[model samples]
Target: MRSPFRRPASRSARSTGVVRVDTRTKRLTKRLQPGEIAVIDHTDLDRVAAESLVERRPAAVLNAAPSVSGRYPNLGPGILIEAGIPLIDDLGPDIMRLHDGQRVEIHDGAVSHMGKTQVIAEGTLQSAESVDAAMEEAKAGLAVQLEAFAANTMEYMRGEWDLLLNGVGMPALRTQMSGKHVLVVVRGYSYKEDLKALRPYIREYRPIIIGVDGGADAVLEEGLKLHMVVGDMDSVSDKALTSGAEIIVHGYRDGRAPGLSRVEDLGVEHSVFSATGTSEDIAMLMADEAGAEIIVALGTHATLLEFLDKGRSGMSSTFLTRLKVGGRLIDAKGVSQLYRTRISGWWLVGLALAGLLALATAIMSTPGGQAFLGLSGVLWDDIINFFRALVGLSPQSPTV
Candidate 1:
C-alpha cells in the first residue's frame, strides 16, 4: 500500500468542512456558503478593509475577535447581525482551524460543534432588532470622543478656510496643483512600512499632496511637502500643524462643534466639514469635489484591522462614499505605471561610471572632488532606491 503519511496539495475531502462565520458586519455583508465561518481580527486600521469584506456578506460573521467582546457599543458584528446575518464574538482560537466552507451550529450566540470538524460560534447575545438601534448606542458611546475630535477639527478648519477664502497666506505649500492627480496618502494599517515604495511617484507627478491628520505628520517626516491636511485634529502632530499645509477640521453632524478651539490656539487656517467618515475619506471627497481628475490611493485600508480601529458607524457612510467615487479610485500600492526608469545592475554600473567621470573632472580642478562625489553618491542612491521600491514594494527607499 502507498504510504498514508503524505498529505494532499489543497484542502482534502475529509477536512473539507465548512468554517463557521460568526460576525454580522464583515463576513455577513455578502453571500456566504453554508460551511464557511468568517474569521474576524479587528485591529486598529480603518474601513478600507470593508472594501474587500463587503463583497462577501456571509451567512454569519464569526467574530473570532470583536471590539470589547461586543460589550462596548460599536459597529462590528453588531451591524452584521442587524443585516440578518448571525454574529458571534470571542470564538477563541480553536475556530481558526477551519476551511472556507464548512458546517456549523450556533446557540446563544456561541459555538457548538455538531459533526466531524463541524464548528459553530456563539454570537453577540444581546441582538439588536435593527442596525439603527445598534448605531444609536454606538454613536452615544462615542459621543465624547467625537465631540473632542470635532472641536479640534472645526478650529483647524475655520483657520484654513479663512486663509483659502481670504487668501491670508495661500496654503504654505500651495502650487498650481489644479490639474494634477492628487493621492492623499494616510498612515493607516497597511500604510505602516508600506509607503516606502511610493516616493518615486511622489517625485514624478508631484501632485497636490494632502494628508489627513497625522498622515500629514508622516508626510512631513518623509521630507515631502504637504499642501493641505484634514481631520478631527485629535491625532495630528505639532510638526504637521506648523508644516505649512492648509488644515481642515471634520466636525460633528449635529453642529455641536468641538475641535475648533484647539485649532485657534495653534493659529492655523482651516475649514469645517460636518460629515461622517474617516479623514482619509474627507481628503478624497474634498479632492473629488474640487475637480481632481484621477485620485490614486496609497496606504488605504481594504482589510479588517483598519475598520475596527475606527469603532464607529462611519463605515456605513464610507461604504456609500466609495460607491459614489468607485471609478475614480485607483490603488497605487505596489503599482509602477506612474514611474519611469528601471533599476538594474547595468544602471548602477552606468551611474558608477558617471560618478567616476564627474569625480575626475572635479578633482582635476580642485581637492573638493572627493567631497562632491560623496554627496552625489548619497543623493543618487536615495533617488535610485526610491524608484526601485516604488516599482517593487521594497523597503529600500526610506533607508537610503
Candidate 2:
C-alpha cells in the first residue's frame, strides 16, 4: 500500500547521488557535501544536530532509525522538512550495508544502487503533518518522563553523593582557578547570543574557560582560549582536541573512560575525572572545588523540555551541582544584561575631542581669539613662503 506522505513517482524522485553514510550524525554532517544524500542512524534528532545538517544543505536525509520516536518533540526532522529537504525514515539497520560514497538512487520510497533494478531498502517519507502528530503524542508522554526523571535523580544522588562532596577522582590541573572567575560554556540553546553578550565581561575579567564536549568548538568559534575541556569527547572536533587546552576526560566510576583513547591517540597530555554527572555538571564542580570566586554558565540547559530533548534520564547531578556552587554560578544571559562596559578608551578619546571642540567654540567668540587667529594665519603664510623659496618655487599663491 502507498503511504499518504509519499509523492507520486516522478523523475526527480528517481534522482541519483553519491551517499555519505555514518552512524554518528555529527560526523556524517562533517563529511556531507551539497547535492549528496546523508545516511545516518540518529534517533530523535535534536535541534543543534538539525541546524548542523541544515547548514550543510544536503539533497536528502536517509535515517536508519525513526527521526521522531515520540520520546520527545525533537526538532531535527521538522527542521529538515521545513527547509524543503526530503527526509526518509526507518529504513532499518540494513541501510547501513550501503557503502559510503557509493552512488545510489532514491525513488518511490525505495533506495537502490545506481544502474541496478534491485531495491536495497525502503523507508517512509516524513512530512510536516506526521512530525506534528508525533510531537503531540510525545507531549502526552512528558508526565511519564518527568516521573522517571525524578526517580532516576534520587537513585543517582544516592550513588554519587560522596563524589560530589569530596571531589573524588578529580585530577589536579596546571590551570589554576583559585580566587578567580570561571566561565563554563555548553553548546546548548542560546549559546551564541549568550557568548556574544558576555564579551565585555570576558575581556575585563579574563576568566578561566571550561568547554563541555561540543562546547569546546563553540569557544573556539568565538575566538576564545579554552583553559580546560571536560566531556566524553565523542562530539568534539579533532581541531578542538588538539587546540592546546587542558583536557579532563569524563570517566565512569568504574574507572573506564571511553573518551580517554581518543586523547591518548592524539598524544596530548590530559587528566581523568571519574564522576556520575553530566560533563557540564562536572565542569562546574571542578571550578568550584578549585576555588573559583564566581562561575558564569553559557548555554547550559535549564528547562524541562531541553533536558528531555537531550535524552537525559535525570538532572540530579545538575540540580545538586547548582546547589553546591550556590550563588557563584551565574547565567550568561543575566551577566550580559546586568553588566555594562565601563568607560572605554574610545569613549575617553571621544570626550577629549568634544571638550576641545567646545573650548575652541568659546575661544572663537572673543575679540582676542580673532586677533590671535589673524596673527597665526600671517605666521602660517610666512612659513609656507619660506618652504616655497627653499624649494625654488614662487612665494605667491599658485593658481588652481
C-alpha TM-scores of all predictions: 0.45, 0.84
User: Candidate 1 at residue 358, lDDT?
Assistant: 92
Q: What C-alpha lDDT, on a 0 to 100 scale, does residue 301 get in candidate 1? A: 55
**lDDT tens digits by residue: candidate 2, 1-400:** 2223333221236678999999988778877999999998988888777777888998888899998888767767777877778888899998898878899989857899999989888988877677767777777777878888788888888988877788776789888999999999987776777887788899889999999988888889999988888999988887888999999999977778989999999998999888887899989988988999999989887677777777666465687788888779888888998766467678999999999999998987899998877788788888888999999999966322
Q: Which lDDT tens digits does candidate 1 get at residues 225-290?
A: 888878777657777877777877777656744667778899987777765456676676666666
How many residue pairs clash in model 1?
60
Worst 10 residues of 2 by lDDT: 1-10
lDDT of 2 at 209: 94
